[model samples]
Every structure is written in C-alpha cells, then in structure tokens.
Target: MLFLKNPQEAHLQCLTFKKEGKSIGFVPTMGALHEGHLSLVRRAKEENDVVVCSIFVNPTQFNDPTDLAKYPRTLEADRRLLESVGCDLLFAPQEQEMYPAPPVLRFSFGHLEQVMEGAHRPGHFNGVALVVSKLFHIVQPNKAYFGQKDYQQYLIIRQLVADLSFPVEVVPCPIVREADGLAMSSRNRRLTPAQRREAVILHQTLQEAKQRLLNGVSVEEVKKWVASVFAPLQKKDIRLEYFEVADGYTLSAVKDIHRHKEVVLCIAAYVGEVRLIDNVLLFS
Candidate 1:
C-alpha cells in the first residue's frame, strides 16, 4: 500500500491511476480505525480497482474546541487496518497541507441544516462540506463510500455531488454495530466501562420507539417515550440531548406520523463526556 501525506503528491498519484484507466474508490475518515471503518474499506475494495482511505481529523468541522482536541488519532494502527483491508492508497494530510488558509466560503443546505446535528453544532455542515469537497477534488475517485450511521451527512454529501455536478458516485453503507446493538463509533473508545454498558440504551430506546410507532402510537407519544427511557439513565450520566421523528428526505419534524411513508428517528446524548448519536429508519 502507498502511504501519502502530501495532498499534491496524492492528487498526482490519483491522476496517474485515472490515466491508466483504474477506477478509484475513496473512503474519507477521521482515524481511530474500528470495524465500522474497515467495513467501508471492504465494500470499496469489492467495487473499485483502487481504494484510497483518508485519515485526517478535520479541525473545521468541530464547533467545540475540546471535542476536536479530544478526537482520537491512531495512525499506526489505522495504517495496519487499511493494509489488512487491501486499501491501495492512504492520504493522511496535515492540517497545514489541507488548509493553508482558513476557509472563507460557507455552504447552505436549506432546511437540511436546521435540525438535529446542524441545529446543535453551528457551522458543522459547512466544515463538512468544505473538507469533503476538498477531498473529492483531491482523490477524484470514481466512487466514494460513507456509512449511513450519519444519515444526514450521507444525504448532505449526496446533495453536494449533485449540486456541484461532480463525476463521482456517493455510496452509503449500513451502520455497523456491536454484538449487543450499540452503534460502532470512534467515540465509543472514550466511554467508561459502565458508560459503555449504559450506552446500549440509545439503540434499545430507538428499537422500542420503532415498535411503538408500528403499533399505532402517535409521533409525539413515541418521542416522549424516548425521553422517558433516558430519564432513568440520567443518574448514570447518560443524558438525552435531542430526539426527533422526521421525514427522511426533508428532515422536517413529522407532526402527523402517518403522513410520511418513511421517517428516521434520530438521537444524540451525552454518555458522560462523550456525546454519541444513533438513529433508526421507520417506514410505512
């Protein structure tokens, strides 16, 4: 596997691959290499001739400085994992290489930015847009893979590709989870042993909510039940930040749950100092 830290060099190498008629598959990640990340690489390897995995912890995306500062960086282990997954290239750029100057431009995603993650993390999607746009340009891959764990993020990148008319396909993979159903996340590393056990409630609550909605419960009542489930966990330091049942496409809150054919139940909470997010899609 070729390990590249320079963006210019990575760009040139990808260009050479293009000239040679190779189809490149790209997976952009903030490193802390877990099975969930490797799952994306495995899918990419199956679909493309060459797979390029990037492990840059983008600073622009974090609204909270402490969160960025505490973000994990495990490059050596990440490289080993990439090599195991048959990744062809690794573009791990320094902040200076990625951003010689602060990004002055901003991205607007209409109402897509007004709820859930965007509502909580101001300018988060703008940073996501800028960095993803940069990576898409640098790799110029025929296909890019992202996990559906961040469903909103997947949708935003889809919009980014369509709006910008990039000649690349955005593929969304399934959310990988632990054996006990906790969604796999890099932040899972920060959870204390007890917090890790308690974290399962996030997924369980979503599952219960899904079943409740299926049983003719009101959207408001399902949302309230989600809060009630988390209420007991507050003593355990698992606090619910927000929960919503919304249209999957527009992401607008669904007042009448029966109106939408498909909606996603999304949640975010503080499990100790580590904030985690998870969701389940409900379809009628």
Candidate 2:
C-alpha cells in the first residue's frame, strides 16, 4: 500500500487512477483502526478498483477539548490493518496540510443539524463536513464508505454531497458491533476495565427499546422505560445523553412509530468519560 502524507501527493496519485479509468472507493476516518474500519475497506476492495482510506482526527469536530486531547492515534497499527485489507492508498495528512488556517464556513442542515448528535455536540457536523469535504476533494473517489454507527452523520454527508455536488457516491456500511452487541467505536479503547463491562448497557438499552417500540408501546412510554434502564447507571458515572426514535430520512422525532415508513432508534451515552452512540433501524 502506498502511504502519502501530503495532500498534493495523494491528489496526484489518485488523479492517475482517474485518468486510467479506474474507480476509486474512499474511506475517510480518524485513525485508531479497528475491525469495523477494516470492514469498510474490505467492502471497498470488492466494489472499486482502488481504495483510499484517510486517517486525520479532525480537531474542529470536538466540542470538548478534553475529548480531542484524549482521542487515540496509532499510525503503525492502522497501516498494517489497511494493508491486510488490501487498501490501495493511504492518505494520512497532518492538520497543517489539510487546514493551513481555521475554517470559516459553517454548514447547517437546519432540522438535521439541530437534533440528536448535533443537539448534543454543537458545531460537530460542521467540522465533520469540513474534513469530509476536504478528503473528498483530495481523494476524488467515485464512491465513499461510512459506517452506520453515525447514521445522522451519514445523512448529513449525503446532504453535503447533494448541496455541494461533490461528484462521489456516499455509501453507508452496517454498524459493526462487538461480541456483546456494543457498537464498535474508536472510543471503546478508552473504556477502563470496569467501564468496558458497563458499556454493554448502551446496546442493551437500544435492544430493549427497539423491541418495545415494535410491540405496540407508545413512543413516550418506550422512552420512559429506556430512561429507567439507564437511571441506575448514573451512580456508576455512566450517563445517558439522549435516546430518540425518529424518521430515518427527515430525522425528526416520530410521534407514532408506525407513522413513518422508516424509523430508527438512536442513543448516546457516557461510560465514564467515553461517549458512545448506537442506532437500530426499524422499517414500518
């Protein structure tokens, strides 16, 4: 696998693929690679002639300075993971290379930006949009892969592509989970031994909530039950951030689960200091 750290060098390498009529599949990520990340790269290998994976933990996306400071970076390990999955190119650029100056433009998706992850993490999507747009430009791939763990962010990037006409297909892969059902995240590594055991609750809560919603429980009542499940975890410093059953496309909280053609259960919580999010889609 060819590893290029400079944006111009990556662009030039990818340009050669374009001129040769090769299809490029891109996976943009904030390093600390895991099975979930490699899963995306493996799928990309099947569908496109070349796969480009980027590792840049974007700074602007973090509302909490502590979270940004604590984020993990393991380049050597990430490289081996990518190579094993047959990734063609790795665009691991420095912040200075990607952003010489702070970004001034802000992207707003109106209702999409105002709820769920956006409501909790202010200015998060804007930073996501910035880095994604930058990578989309640098790689110039025919298709881009993103995991469904961040379903809202996937929707936002689809919107970004539509609004900006980025000329790349935004494809969402499934949420890869651990053996215990906890959604796989880079943050999962930060969980202490005890916190790791406690982290399973987020997935358990999501599972119970999904079944209840489908079994004729009212939205309000289902939310109450979910809260009650997490209520006991507060003592352990594991706090539930927000849980909502919403329209998959519009992302507005659904009053009646059956009313929407596509419904999704999304949740976020903190197991100690690590913030984790997960979602399960329900079709009506």
Candidate 3:
C-alpha cells in the first residue's frame, strides 16, 4: 500500500525492512494492471513477508516511439489491484528519478539476443537488462518474480543476475493466458475486438504444433506445419515476425529436433499493429 516515487526513498525503505528482518519479494512491471500481472503479485505474497511491485513503463524497451506513447498507464487502478493482491509496497519511479541521464551502459547476450524479439526489437533486451538491473539494486529483494510469458526476457535476466552477481533470486513463473488461449499481455489493451479474435491464432498455432509433435511428427515436419499455420495469419494482416522450433534451454534454433533435447515452439506476430508472442515446449 505504501508508494515510493524516488529510488533513494525506495532503497532506504528496503534497507529499513532488511534491518527489521522482513524478507522482500519483488514483481517489476509496467502498469495497466491485468490478471496476468496480478498472478505474479499473488505468488510474491505467498513466499515473501514484504512484496514490492514496481510500475515503471521502461522507456528503453520500446522499439517504436508510437508504441511507447500508446502504452497504457493506469497507475491508480494498478495500485488498487496490487493492494488487493496484498502487495506491501509500490515503487512508481518517475522517468527522471529512474534515468537522470540517457543510459550509457548496455548488455549483450551474444547469440541469445540475435533472434526472435531481439532481432525485431534491437537493443530491447539491453534496455530490459539495464532497467531490471537498476530495479534489482533499488529493491534488493530476497526474490524477484517474472512471468514465463516473456520466456527470453526471463532467461536474459537470469543470465544478467549470474553475470553481475545480483544477490536476489530471479523466479520464473508460468505464462498466464486467457480463456480462449491468447497469452495475457499488458499490450493486449491495444487490440481491437476484431484483432482480439484474430490474436487467438498465435496460441492455436502453437497448440497444433505441440499436438503434431505429440502425434510423433518429425521436427522438420512440425516446423513446416507451424510455418504453414502462420502463413494465413500473415496474409490476413497479422505480420509474422519469426516462427521457429528451438532448444528450450538455450533458445537456439533446432535444425533437426533431437529426441533427448527439449525444444520450444515460439512465435511473434502482429495482429493489426499490436505484436503478440506465444510459445510452447516439445519434450521427448
């Protein structure tokens, strides 16, 4: 329920809580509260004594200026929702407070940052890593929660933590989806009713791909099947960014699906102008 708008104040609060022996759990998010975000908050509430949810729409992550401008900001509603989920603190740092100067340092993830969301949105993960690094420092929580809906983002953060030696644990939670299977996202707000209906295809394609694999289809066959499923969507004004089957752990493209190696079927597409991503795993 307590809100801190400055990093220094939030850092002091976290320090005070640490002195008082309260364990902190943090959920970092951009606002426009949704059920998916609330799900993360609920998990934080269960495991840590004090839960801190941050609502700063990181400016650096957006590839398009208009997309950044269009991103919904409903802090008041988000605050009420966080409180309802029993979150103890809300760190709503202003742009100036968080980024006094333009970020100079960057994070490079080698091959991991060269495809999928990275290929489409250049420097996006660097922005993500920088802001996340800043928040991790500011909150200094015992644990931080992130949704697997952003699987690569979760992976990159895990790598960032290991590389920088952030003391907090980065916990990856499952992707929260809607009744019709569309993955819940903060950007879902931008979808028109017609576009929302079309958005279901992303999940549907992934499901079909998964079922095909379950039916003993070869990896090459499944890749072709997924690509074919997406072709129609792309023609229908749903821009297909990338669709591939890849190693689950490394996120590397799987040329020939290995039996013992776990792989994921991932896709990113634009329904209307709003880009959506969804993925599923294929395990032998």
Question: Given candidate 1, what's the lDDT at residue 226?
Answer: 84
- Pairs that collide in candidate 1 are none
- Tens-place lDDT per residue, model 1, 55-165, is 999999999999999999999999999999899999999999999998899899988888899999999999999999999999999999999889889888999899999
Model 3 lDDT tens row, 1-284:
89989999999999999999999999999999899889999998899999999999999998889989999999999989988889999999999999999989978998788888899899899999999999999999999999888888888899999899999899988888999999999889899898999899989988888787778787788777777776776667887787878777788877666544788888898898888898887763
Write down the TM-score of every candidate: 0.98, 0.98, 0.96
Worst 10 residues of 1 by lDDT: 253-262
Task: List, in order, the clash count of every candidate structure.
Answer: 0, 0, 0
Cα lDDT computed for each candidate against the true fold: 0.93, 0.93, 0.88
Q: 37-122 in candidate 2: lDDT tens per residue?
A: 99999999999999999999999999999999999999999999999889999989988988899789988899999999999999
In model 1, how large is the Cα lDDT of residue 171?
Answer: 95
Q: Which stretches of candidate 3 lie over 4 Å from their true place?
A: none
